[model samples]
Target: MQNFESLNLFAPLEKALRELNYQTPTPIQAKAIPPAIEGMDILGCASTGTGKTAAFAIPILDFLGNEKPRTRAYHPTVLILAPTRELVIQIADSFGDYGKHMKFRQTLVYGGIRQDSQVKSLKHGTDVLIATPGRLMDLMEQGKVKFDDIQIFVLDEADRMLDMGFLPALRKIVAKLPEDRQSMFFSATLSPTIRELAATFLFNPISVTVPSKALTADGVKQSVRYVQRDEKVNALHSYLSSDKVDRTIVFTRTKHGANNLVKKLERQGIVALAIHGNKSQGARQRALDAFRDNKIKTLVATDVAARGIDIEGVTHVVNFDMPVEPESYVHRVGRTGRAGAKGIAISYCTSAETKELKAIEKLIGFDLRVENPKFKFGESAPAAKGGKSASGKSQGSRRKNKSYKPHWQMKGRNKRRSKTASA
Candidate 1:
């Protein structure tokens, strides 16, 4: 498929994709791109790491090529909206890489950094804009950025946009755009509200989903151990000590827990890193990069995939703690088994977390092979008398009705948008 080429695609894109080792088109890409290039509204439903970035990006880059800039004002010709600061940065970088052959001017906006700098980036009149809903809306409110001229508008990670609490801001921003324009929405999973929100923007969209995310990517081998609450760290130690896991990301429920886990690993003479909300922005980037570059062997984080991290070759995703929500399990383990590479997700559960474990199984629609670890393959989490069942009510569906507030609250403006969207 490396030899495969399309007339609409420019020379630079072909060469860049080859360099990155992207050969054949994934199902999501093969189906979504043609219609997108033809100016059709697209609703892409693929799980994380299905090359969704390039799916939307290749089309946008081709559409906006050689189009005059939006003058001195910050009204973008191509606006890519994402849910988190990490995603914002990643999309910007993707634009840069994909459009390297062309003179594509782009900028990114998110809340972690100073707003003044972002405003200045807009003043230069970028052609392509990637941003999170909050900072983008804030800039629009200040009259620093405009959307009247936006020709291509994309909402990447659509479900996540709702999860991050950006529905209100998304509606406000979309309301400001020209009613007739090419709009696209991409997400791992779409709910009723996401559908309602998409209807308000997308015109006759083509919706597509890669196979069931629950099927567990063919490359990944999953297993679980029902250890006592106090025994988890030791079990994880055993796994790490075996030399099987070259790189690892341990997911924990709380910010403090992630940090403590990293510290504990260090005390045991294993250097590691932790990334969560409380850490400074610089620290998070450093930790992620260090792990990716193999400077650090272990990295711990909270369950936010928006952390704009795409570290290739992640061998194992250890659920140091099982997620409270099953939908979250998709995003958590998703950090591994990326880009069609093989990976593993090992969840360490105690009787207390049995309900959470069962909830994940139900949502994924299949029972994960719960192994005793000590015995062999295809074993189940050990049964103790009256212990909670690993099969319980799915939690993914339960968290769907949430109202996510953007990380950055704009004082008076937030209340109105929040109320309307959540209501």
Candidate 2:
């Protein structure tokens, strides 16, 4: 409970943890690892940056490393199913790092690339297999993969799998696995839908929830700017130019929005790359590698593409477009302020998005600070007559007759007005 050493992990695993500089167990790890080591099915509710991967990965490695090797041809001892290709790769890397001193063979398979390499790896035997649901199903249908030898089955990001319409595939995959095996379900948020799905797979699972005071990471400082719809790009440019923003991830609502934002940033002499579902796996990986290696300062992405991205030294997260789902905001800002490092989350909100912002605030149970000086608290347009601010307080009470004059709008107002009139 106090440290990883106290968990009685195998010597090799302990050594690997020390090599990875994992001195203390995170809250989720501290609670979930013990039960997981006991061979009990685990239901964990933890977000991306909370070290949940290690909570599950360490116990599995410790158990498999000590167990006798099964004489199986195409079957793996452990199977981890994730939603995104990025997550599948990330989880595979964690297993490799944790099992370095052991003789655990692991292979990861996902879509968006040739399967010849993955098939060749599967032709040999492996102790661990990590894969995305779609490719896993494809390989299974071809009889190239087997779960007969599986001792443990892990469903990582269960909610994401459902969100991406993998529920049917997941059910089909789970039906093939031996019901006698231990199951582990880990996700950021466990809704009723996820719970029902878990019930079908896990047996008397030990539930663990690492509660946060706020949905966002503790190290992230959150703020918002009241900018007009058209002026968001300028505001983002201004913020990124600051010295405080070393490396940042800018979240947009749509894939096109992400690409367009990158273009706009490039025109202004700011270098950035965009990642979305449409990008090939190689392209997405290249952009992520550039950002991680510090070759690029900013990476533009949509909510779906940004999932499972774990990079260090990310100083800021810019929400170019507020997400309709409040839970997504938590995941967006979570890209930064990771691994106990301090980071900042800034949201650009326009008048049209006030309702979405309010919904996010209500979900998070706090008011985001309005940090833009040009827009006074009561100076902006009246919030829809009966609407409320993100704080759940009445908007009419905060409305004022005074008009706001943004600095950017003042300079080109007449020229823009003339151009519009001429058109």
Please tell me which predicted candidate would have the highest TM-score against the true structure.
2
Residue 68, candidate 1: alpha-carbon lDDT: 40
Which residue pairs clash within candidate 2? none
Q: Against the unseen true structure, what C-alpha lDDT does each candidate score?
A: 0.75, 0.85
Question: Candidate 2: minimum summed lDDT over ten consecutive residues — where?
Answer: 414-423
TM-score: model 2 vs. ground truth:
0.86
| Best-matching candidate per lDDT | 2
Which runs of model 2 end up more than 4 angstroms from their true locations? Answer: 214-218, 373-423
Task: List where candidate 1 sits over 4 angstroms from the true fold.
Answer: 1-4, 18-23, 66-70, 305-308, 373-423
lDDT score, candidate 2, position 169 = 97
lDDT, candidate 1, equals 0.75
TM-score of each: 0.82, 0.86
